[model samples]
Target chain A: MADSTKKKITVLMVGNPNVGKSALFNRMTGANAMVSNYPGTTVDFTSGTLIEGRQEYEIIDVPGTYSLEPRDAAEEVAVRMIRDHPDAVVMIVFDATKIDRGLYIALEVMEQGMLCIVAVNMMDTAHDKKISVDTADLQKVLGVPVVATTATSGEGIRELAEQIRKAQVADLDKIIKRLNGEIPDKKSVGGCGGCGGC
Target chain B: MQKKLLELEFGERGVVREIRTSVHDLNCMGIRVDRELKMVTKQPIKGPVVVLLGEMQIAIGLDLAAQIIVDVIGKDA
Candidate 1:
């Protein structure tokens, strides 16, 4: 069943809202992605093909999510993408200007047992705001590859592609256990946590 | 091609441009559009406002277009 010839890589882009995830998707796939202020515009998954190192890859852009737990239907899809597609490389796109919030999601993604790559998107904006993020420090903390990029202006897009070529397929059974067991019971999340009002 | 994209993204009639302020002061200020610049105002246009593409079907009239342009861009509209 394995072609064994052409290596098809699927890069899943996941992160918090307003980090220019769709913008980076457009730059990678050369597809003009639709952008908006409000979150959840990208509900379903989107895939595009890019030729890299004589191999074709199906780059995936999953919906924006905040945590490992399925906070809602969208997070369920995001977690499902990680569970169902273990072979895909997970690219955690975080806002350089606001790395604290995105970093939280990055930690949750790491818990999913995927070989993750952290890309700090919107460096230009961060720089303009006089905000600077130590990408090296982030990688150390996250235990993954960290890349700085200004996705809007096409900066650091090529490095992202080249890195995708070197992405490794993570094991699956291990991921499944985490999805089911690793998620903390909502009952312990305190009262009025939103979901089910329990 | 720019106009076509503007038409496609904004709508057939939705044409807006970014209007630069004259005083060049204040933390936030509203302005209008510059058809020549091919940009629009999105309110508090100060700071690093991300210029993004809006969905089609949301079309604005010429008067509103001039208002948006002049409101954010400048009186040149």
Candidate 2:
């Protein structure tokens, strides 16, 4: 068996475009930053070192894409980066106002069976629109910790970071099978109230 | 009459009548068929078109806008 203790922990930031992925990255990493192209790809990605408690995490800001499906060059880079680091903690930043679309991508990521956390960004806008989302309800549906946040104001970001540190791999085997059309069960499909997400 | 969203001039009003592609892409911006839209911005030559929908603003690529069919509302005709 390989030594798991030697493995380095990485936190990958991902979300749809304009969902404040970069803002969140800046908040988490502070100053020391490196903006570089992904190895052989022309697409650029930002990375920085973030220390949480006793552990140091290599946080990477991935390019935003609507879905894991590569519709363009930037999307290809994002998908490849996520696939390359299967062990990295995936932080999915989503817009609270556009939860349906965000949830669709969230399901796709979870289908890959990676450790994930759902950060419901733009909470301020959601509040202004009178749209209320219960993170606990979402957590129960996604089988992961869901944190509400307003990246611009830094609201709930501390709780998000703490949850990120405590993130774990979700049990998505059954859901993956269902999404892939290998099963016929629809009970869990509406658990999140038809928002296309939980 | 029905026309592509790309054809709608700035400040032009219309109702999104159809989306030729998957609704998933448009859903992110809260766009759906029958929603009232206003052309807020359209850059010269190949650029994204900004559309105002209620309180939300969505910037859509020209290529994608071509696939979105809208019925002219003629608010500022």
Candidate 3:
């Protein structure tokens, strides 16, 4: 079990584009400051901290990417960091309507031997689609905690944080098949929607 | 009262996290998006109000956007 207090753990916020990585960062870090950065402004990553219920943790919002391999300079940093191994990984935050595609990244992270907490984001849209995911089943298969959320409305941010605190490096081998023949290679995909579609 | 995607971020709104644009939309706007990002607008704004990829700004108006949402994101919605 990873101790939440002793080590300087960094929780990396990752997922496909537009699933609300930035929104989740704002919710977790309260980055209500720093708005516009000129017209052509682009930022690779941002760091924020969470001080909640007397517990503290560092959060880094990596640029969103589809895979974990370097296809471009910006995504290379994000993908490389995961391979380099930060502290913890949160995989979820993609098009809710595209669940199959979203799981692709989760499988990639699992391959890296990191204990993960799958965030099944965009429940509002899922509800609209009449899709009810068996979160327990997802947890059972993914071998980690799974929390559904509409990050913008902040439906499951707390659960996500709590789950992050509880994450353990589970057996990464169990998820090798679900990668859709792809790994956490962010370099293998398209450009970022950060300009801001994901 | 607005004509550009940059206009949406104005006033007291959430922090502008990202902006997504499409070359397809720009060709329609007849506006050259020299940089990697840009926005698109149409008259009467008869569509959904959306921020694509959060960048390639297209003010399709609410009615059109609602219809498009039902068509595009409805399957997932």
* lDDT assessment of candidate 2: 0.77
Q: Tens digits of per-residue lDDT for model 1 on A77-171?
A: 88899889877789989878657567667666666677777789989988987878877544433435677898879999887777664433333
Q: Evaluated with DockQ, which candidate comes out highest?
A: 2
Q: In candidate 2 chain A, what residue range of length 10 has the lowest lDDT sum?
A: A33-42
lDDT of 2 by residue, A130-167 (tens): 98988866675566778899877989878787777666
lDDT of 2 at B32: 81
Runs with alpha carbons beyond 4 Å of true place in candidate 1:
A1-4, A167-198, B1-77
After aligning candidate 3 to the native by TM-score, how far in Å is the CA of A174 from where it should be? Answer: 3.2
The candidate that achieves the highest lDDT relative to the unseen native structure? 2
lDDT of 3 by residue, A10-104 (tens): 77777765666777778878885233322211137788888655567777777766567645666676787676655565545554655655676
Report the CAPRI category for model 2.
Answer: acceptable
Each candidate's lDDT (Cα)?
A: 0.61, 0.77, 0.55
Residue A105 shift from truth in candidate 1, angstroms:
1.3
DockQ of each: 0.02, 0.26, 0.04
- Positional deviation of residue A188's Cα in model 2 after best superposition, in angstroms: 18
Q: Candidate 2 regions off by >4 Å?
A: A1-6, A32-43, A128-131, A165-198, B1-18, B21-49, B53-55, B61-63, B70-77
TM-score of the first chain of model 3 = 0.75
